[model samples]
Target chain A: MMDRMAVTTTTRVAELHELLARHETSPAAGNVPVHPELVELFPRGLRTGAVYSLHGSMSAALALLAGPSAAGSWCAVVGVPDLGIEAAADWGVWLDRIALIPRVPAGEWTSVVAALVEVSALVVAAPPEHISPGEVSRLLARLRTSGSTLVVLGNWPRAVATLTGQVTRWDGLYDGHGHLRGGSLRLEVTERQRTRYADLELPVRP
Target chain B: MISAAPIRVLLLWCPGWPVLAARLVQGIAADRALALTDRGVVVACSPAAQAEGVAVGLRVRQAQHRCPDLVVLPHDVAAETRAFEPVLRAIEEKIPDVHVVRPGLAAVKARGAGRFYGSEEAAAHALLTHLQRFTADELRLPVDLRMAVADGLFTAEHAAYSSSARQPLVVVPTGRSRDFLAGLPVSVACDRRLANLLQRMGIRTLGDLAKLPRAQVNSRFGAPGLRAHQLASGEDSPILRPRVVPPELGLHVAFDPPAAQIEQIVLRCEPAAEGFVQLLTRSALICTEIRVTVQLEPDALFERLWRHPWQFGKTEVLDRIRWQLEDLATEAVTTDDETLGASVLSVQVLPESVDNAEHHAQGLWGDRPDEKVEHALTTLQHRLGHESVLTSTVAGGRLLHERRVLRPWGDALPTLRERRLEQPWPGTVPGPSPATVFSSASQVQVLSADGAPITVDERGTVNERPTWLRTHEGQRRIEQWAGPWPIRQRWWRKVKQLNRFQLVDNHLTAWLLLSDGAVWFTEARYD
Candidate 1:
């Protein structure tokens, strides 16, 4: 029997490219101009305007949204607004093109979140003071429909818990002297959800 | 034969965190987990525990009945996450990129970090030692966490969970990731739905899951299943995201405050201007115009612009701004004016141009010459305020209203007429009526004193019915008259609506005008 999981991913990647091809207006050949950060997370660029909540280090997000191409790409970080904005600016992201939506009380934020999803490529939203299974599913659907990626910044969404693909674990270790060993650390990213692919660990040396 | 790279994972699951802590208290590296509660320590005695013959949800009495020697302790979520940060920080100080997949689990790239710390196995040990230190500090507890470096993230996660003190890190060879996951359970592969789906398909092991048709699995499981498929086959490498540089011209200077007098302010700007000029010199660029901000205590912050001067010189630039500050003091009768006492916190310089050859040629010679033209404008704007020093340029338009553009000393963009006019602009209702407008515009109602309807015919004529109009500022009666000017615009626009109105006046010197649901107040007399 053919490996079901491996075949699904290959076909999915092809289907996505076909959809993106339908939206291309410019005559640029080969690959479309995509934000590099999205490329790292999802090798293919995410859809233009949607909500994605990436729950990880500030540096991780910074690595993606730091260039002229990012300006036209709008993102709103919900919980850590100041840190997110400052880091975005540090990464060459323009302030004029970006909008910062403040953090709201628990459980009340989702009502207004759908509004922002229309114009932004990525939105960082936490479950309002409380998170519901419906809200998580709805958020995922909204992101998928809008061609956006959602990064739930804290715990993984309990509703749609099945994980697929590689999950990278990050860690920072201090040297004997304690000075930051710049760009010198360890990284462990493993394949958690897949069909044809074997579960593997990706290690970064420098 | 080339060997493949391995994924480095830090697994921290030891059942209940407290049970693990209790084990450490007994001078053993605890593998059992526990939690602290309001009443006392509570061990997470559940099915997974009871499967091993431990009791489910009971007091210490009942739990001990099931397994008297069972490891027990308190629960603490905060301690786990907190104690976890230092271990991460310690690893992060050495790694280029690190991610905490869960409170206890971490994913690190092994190739780079392993080389820095030596071999892959050695790097794993160093991390374990560091984490042991962190865990030891938190509960004075001994911990036996494990590390697994494989080709993919899933295998590493599984390996970490399965590893014991006897065999910590299972370093799988490159291209062997697929083989390693063959025997792993599919339950560990996903959350609930896919896990159930895989179980339904009778595919419990990763190898069994990989055997099914991919297209069918993807269509059935949706996005999450598609991802699961990719991982089982050992695809999707985690690429590290790097930072990009920002482009902006910023200059900042902090000063000791409470400095009074224009002379003192002028003196303060000298160094700032000099510093800005020095920066421009180093970059081989000349700033055409500069914006100066004056910090006024107890009230407001004042901002102005300086025009681009022809000559470029450091001395000239600083001297001109100094002169502008000094002139402001003398221009006012009393030096105690609101504008006089403000001290400048810092000055910013925008490099408006780098096209000048003289600047580049001078830079080639290692000489940082200052710009005299920018210096002159800086002073002029400082003394007269930015708005006072304006430049005018002709703009293309059929109407006199749109004929010209005005700019302050340092502001860069051209003046625009329409609100967000870049796209299909909204044109105002048309009429060739007034030569000038001033004061305010108000709305009015036309009527006869006896309440009989006063009619105004088309073509700007009023019948002898004693018609009246009202001013918006107040509901005063009409006192004067002007011809009715009817106009239409956007005839080409679809679904067009009428926006026509007549000009009338209310009682008193105040004049009122009405059009298209809006009223305006204009002055009666022309200069």
Candidate 2:
């Protein structure tokens, strides 16, 4: 049942580690906490073709749009019905990024992104219906390896999987921000390659 | 002469019971009302045949003896309050500054009303119309409603009680309220006991009360009488208070033709829910409970409660909603039962909060599995209703039957015991498990017959050593077999639990095998 899937996913991580080591990502060879091979995820703060938990994915996109400015961009947002965007705005990201979209039915939503895709680096799209595994596989295979990021949000997906080399799963909070609030994320990455390394949990900047 | 905005007053009484001048006054509906006897009616305007010098308060027989044409109206308290609503509404509309004196009286700042709504006469006409409409709408009043819009609440109130011939509306010129009361009788005010006491003191007119030393009247009449005096003299100070209203918010979507299909309904509602989320976003609140209400037919409405919360996004919301619609669509519909119709009438989001953050407070952020597990369970429940699906584990007993159970989650399982998984795990069941599990639905076929293995009757009877026979799709033979292990529970109960087991499926897809010494059963499958 579901137990098999969990076992399969766990086994895949070991397979991914083998692939990373094959790619020359050696633990003793690299100085940083993350394997040298996966450091490529943030090349100048651009989220290069990686899977992210919705909010974490959004943070990466916000990091890109805000540039080097300590105080990020301001926004006038709309249409992000289910997302509590204020959670991000508090981290010093300005609100000019917000815009309200009128009602968009679930079935007719993918095409709605054509206009938003060009201007906004990160357009939070709540797909109208469940995206099939075939659809997800199709989307992953079609990626041109460009620098753009898309964050798909939900209450919880029954299971998550994609056909990609790097599988960066979110394990949760990073230490030392504050007692009650303030901290970043601890993302455990499984780089599926044949050469060097994979399967490691590391805290990146918030 | 008055130079500033004139004061406005409205007096109204709904209805009570009748006893005295006080009772009649108490029973009046308009901001003000008067209890008039046949004799009082006669004294005011009736022909000499009706009046014949009959004074107020005389019995009907005495009035009839005094004047044969006197007309009488039995007291009506509720009718009076109903009658007053229109006048209250009218005066409220024309001169917002008015104060209600009681069931029968009202007053307005005359100078402003006269200038704005056009002369005092026009304003009074407007007030009368407003009251008349109220009477028609609320009281079903048959009587032609009447009222006087004057300089003071007292004058307007008296005017309301007066016959149409007596001028229902009169303008007491600026600074004239006091002057207008000069000839009025002392008993016209509500304090009849005080009025009678004053009358015993030889003061029968308003002028007589005003004529008494202010100090003497203050000492003799007490505060109620003093208030009554102030009212009679048109000098009462009004203290206005506003009414409190309840706080409730709802978001509704109306489609052009109404949708019956769940997908179509979800399409319209996701955005509406988004809109609902947006409206309440500024309030620093989150909802864990939502009741889905659907109006299928013009006459039929269906509603169910969704008690679940998300740690993050709206995915769980959309999934459960869609799955619920799917489950509903699969129902065994009858001729009378309407399939979901077209046009989703509305989706209402109930406000529930897991966090009571102030407007500026931040929600607790961290990786939380409970919110995650809850989201999954809710999605399953919405797609399955309360009965069909379950997460079953063997517990709470020593016997095989008693050892089986279903624990609750956000999904519908039998019970919920709040357990913490933050610490090192101990008692959880081992994994690498079966894919599909069952509880009460599928029955087992036993194959224990005479010369061979026991076979189950299609009706489930078995006298021989039973062999497991379960049917779903097709009959596939047992590939490999595992256990006849025993489970016993509920030693406290007279009927203890005794469950025997075996795993029989050729492909290594595990299926739970069992028998109660007497009968065998199939419990689950590894999908």
Candidate 3:
């Protein structure tokens, strides 16, 4: 009976360590605030020093930028030549504090982004056509040291979370009739190997 | 405050100095009809131009019509100041404490010079002789100079202006300045509106203005009028504070055999940059702007003024030099000038503006947090060209592309001419703004349900409803569609009539498409 109890106790200790490990590695406990609507997905807000990959939607990426930007944090957008500033402003971004670098040459992409990560609270960029893993790690090191979050428009390897969104339903448009007023966005959020789903409206109302 | 006995001042005046400076710097003949214009209005004119009725305050076209052969040049203040520097230096050799009133005028106290020379009149003549010799012998451009010595700066300046070419020096006897200035017009007080008001009040001459009771003048005309009254009555005790000559802070770096690469020049300038900052620190000042003058071998000279948001450090100075060299290198490829491709011989770094260190002191708490971000942006600007890093403002326009205005970081945003965001730009795409706006529109094929090309008419009617959108990726069936919102702009100049459409495809993503009657283009995406 003592041997069986010891075995059970050992399993209990192992389970507790596993829980502690997950908590320690997860960035969900970070302090940077997200939008109130996004609180369900990010319980503790956006994690500083964490890389978040976005897929199939630029508006979703802009929605992420709008939160910290409205909260008076400086944000930078690099390599997104056609980023809509009006849409960002519509989503409640403070345009005055945002830096928009439309293009960084392929060769200077890593260094430029690394330098930018040192100062801004959040950096949004489209990953260049080709980037080495070594350069990515160097940039990630800077992000960790500076406590700045990196939001990638395209896929980024080793991102802490990946956000994929699609326009599931669009409102206020018909066959040769009304204009595009608002729409519904279906979001698939994956963090720490777990996936969750969310549905929200475009141009999130104040 | 007016003292009982106003100190004596000697004034030197040069009329039409802008025209003379143009002649000296631009090689324009001063004897010909010449006028200097600022913003299309004549600011100054030469004797020949004045004889042709081309005077100050005349528009450029009017002056040109009056003279017919008038040589009009844009007034450049820097060139005027640069050409006047040697003349000021020449006078400084004779008068130890000369105060420059303007580029063309200077003032000095007459008491010390009078004591050194026999009399105030002799001191004035000695100063004039010294300037004439310097201009005639050294500069080779002899100027028509005038001098006056009187009880106060206002009367001394007026006396110098009133002196003729024949009698270039005018001296008012002590305590007789009021009598000397009595015959001059009230406009000599240098207040145009006040002079116009006084003229309407029948105070045409300085003597008429001086005859008014002082208390009455104070009560009726206010402070400026009372000061004008004091000037007319010779009670203007103007303070003549001598200007300290600026120390030599400019650095010259010469690369022997010339620098072939920008990095080489930047490397060589490291020590010079350190020394430049040290020089400013020693003077208890900081440089905020610098003029980098680069000289290329065989004769191409280029200079650009670089302004820093904060005081320039050694690294910033070096970065500016590197950026300038890189800019010159790029210009060489586009321009046909072979001299620009030649090696760079030397560079001159001159401080354009310097401020006291006390004004730039750090706060008691710490530096503002925006500085780190600002510095980072500046670093990015150095790596990329100045126009690469930008801050955007949502300006007013019908199209998505035209609505957002991008300004280079650290540059002053141009005033929104008429495109203010508050204006109700009618017929714009309604509702939520698109997320991705193409910098330049990309062509797309829009077809009807019957697989025929779609077009819009001038009357804002679509020939057929667009049911399919064909991009480079593939064709997508339209789920819903709207808009033939006609955008007509600049109809009198280049008439642009465009019909816009909003289409939601099978994937549920919306696209903002524009049709210029025949061709269709995707302007933005709601994704």
Candidate 4:
């Protein structure tokens, strides 16, 4: 199944490259780059002015931002105080440009997010419990106008894409004697805009 | 062979400037007698006080006795300098390079400006004219302003001092400075003791002093005498080097209909921001301090100074503008509308301090991964908030939580620690650190094999080794365990002590447990 997904993604990427060549413009003109492992999940690359919802694995979501962040784009993580900085650094998320606002007041969350979007290219946030659909829509509008991408950690109504990760197997530990060196996770990405789905198993390193 | 002649210098002098500055701030009438006193001595007195017999170096009581109605104000150096800032700005508008000698005095190289303004005389006249107009129109004070041009700073200052209010300017002809100083008193060359010595030697005037043999004067007066002889002979001192004036690059934007919304104002400022950054890049200069001015409707103005830890680019500029506008909008709503008013008529960005960009540019040999990260982090901080992004640093302490410190980005790392890390922390848990530290320790129950609750004694001893752990997740058998170390802190004052134990569960999850003689609390988890 993984091989089939890879073949289908390669064909889609080839078609995209042809279209891009005909247009005579760079593919990165209006897109944010993603990790090579996530190429099968987002064959055309992540859109610059859109939102994606990632569930289950925080490390996987952070890995998705490594490429763009390392390429000189600023990223912010909001409302996640317990986020392990060591884990983030291990996944190649440049800690220098990664802003972490552990918590924000519910009433000021929208404005804070808007402010962050004005300066940062990518903002990963967990929406507060009291946020309404109207507020989210307004934030999305601002994000679109500013050409910033939003990566939501939980369910975001009408998200452009949704990604979920499930750990398949844990390795490097025998009867708790050895350290937990790494693991394997099955990442399932579903695109709401194209009604397409892709799944791939990737290594998870802590 | 002959070297080039010395450059001409121009001096602008404002006599009794400290008294004038103090009176200006206090709104005292010009005709009133005012004396600035420092530590019971009169440092400076106004013209009115001088007329009544008050003078500098006089005791405050003596001045008061001389002039009964004298207003004695304490001398404030900062106020004098602050009042002089406007005068410097006015002079800089016409002249590119001007050096402030002190609060009441300023000097500039006259050769370039003289040629530009037709002659040395014309330059002095033009500067005096501009200053007189500025004092009359802007300052609205009748001040005694004087200007003079000559071959050196000392002669120029002397000429400015000798000029009367009617003329207010004196220009000594080029290459004739020695002749101009020939008739001046010997006291102008040195202190009273040297003047007395010169007088005793029949040298009553500067020309007489200049006529003495150089070696004879040097042998008698040492370096001070030689310097005085050089000055009297109209030779310029090598210490007075002219300062280089940097180019001023400022960007301004005026709204046609005036903008009130923060977003609209930010959008309008985009072009100016881009232009400002481009200009700085072209000049190879990086601005570290930015002065932003916001003009409001009907004469209300908002101004603020912003500083950057590193060089500021277009994104940082735009972010600061938005933040300032948002703050102003809030003020308008909370305060009276008449004070803050509505709408922004114009916005100006002026770089207050700049440095050569080449000095701070990244190297070409190695990859600067840290630089890229810092750039991104600062941009995010500009947008979100300064305190939102933080970096963790290890501090010296006995406890794990106390040793960890989180500081905002761009702040200097703390160097001082509460306790030395090299010292042995007797009660601290040894080995690898925990993966997760709970904000608050969770309560747990540890029981012996006989189904009795395990506890610690005041003597720092545990009841049993074999145990079952009951946590929020449910009961589990202990696989391996070590430690019942006791820590006594503030025992004399608060009387607090804790016994720490390291235990592993059946699931192989290690836990650091703390007991205060009663209950067990899970402090951290090693995953």
Highest-DockQ candidate: 3
- Stretches of candidate 2 exceeding 4 Å from the true structure: A1-206, B1-108, B122-149, B182-205, B219-222, B238-252, B261-294, B298-527
Model 1 per-residue lDDT tens digits across residues B1-527: 11133344333333344444334334443333222332432345433346555543466655555665555555555565655665566556555456666556667777776788778788878877776676678546555677787665666776676777777666766677678788887876678777887888788887887777779878988877766766777654454232111135434444566555555655666676677665554443456665555554555555556554332455555644554555544554664653454555544444445343333332321221122323433444454454543333334432222332344544443535432334442333222112122213233455566644444444334444334544344444443344333333322223123233323233112221333322222322110
Q: Give the share of true interchain contacts found in each model.
A: 0.00, 0.00, 0.76, 0.05
Worst 10 residues of 2 chain B by lDDT: B359-368
Compose the digit string of candidate 4's lDDT tens values, residues B337-427.
2233487899999998887654444321122223445665565566556677675544555455555455677543454554355666666
TM-score per model over all chains: 0.32, 0.30, 0.74, 0.44
Separate DockQ for every predicted complex: 0.01, 0.02, 0.29, 0.05
lDDT preference between candidates 1 and 4, better one: 4
**Quality of model 4 by C-alpha lDDT:** 0.73
Instruction: Please rank every candidate by TM-score, starting with the best.
Output: 3, 4, 1, 2
Which parts of model 1 have CA positions greater than 4 angstroms off?
A1-206, B1-89, B95-107, B112-121, B131-148, B153-176, B179-206, B212-228, B241-467, B472-527
lDDT of 2 by residue, A1-206 (tens): 33453355445545654553464321112111112323444333324233333332333323323332122211211133322222233233333333223235454343333333322334445454565665554444332132233444432232121212222432221121111111222333222432222232222223
Residue A165 in candidate 1, Cα distance off native in Å: 67
- The CA-based lDDT of model 3 is what? 0.83
Per-prediction count of colliding residue pairs? 118, 100, 0, 0
Report the C-alpha lDDT of model 2 over B180-287, residue by residue, as the tens digit: 676778888746787788778787877667666656677877886676566556664433332111135345666667666666777777776666654444333445
Model 1: DockQ score:
0.01
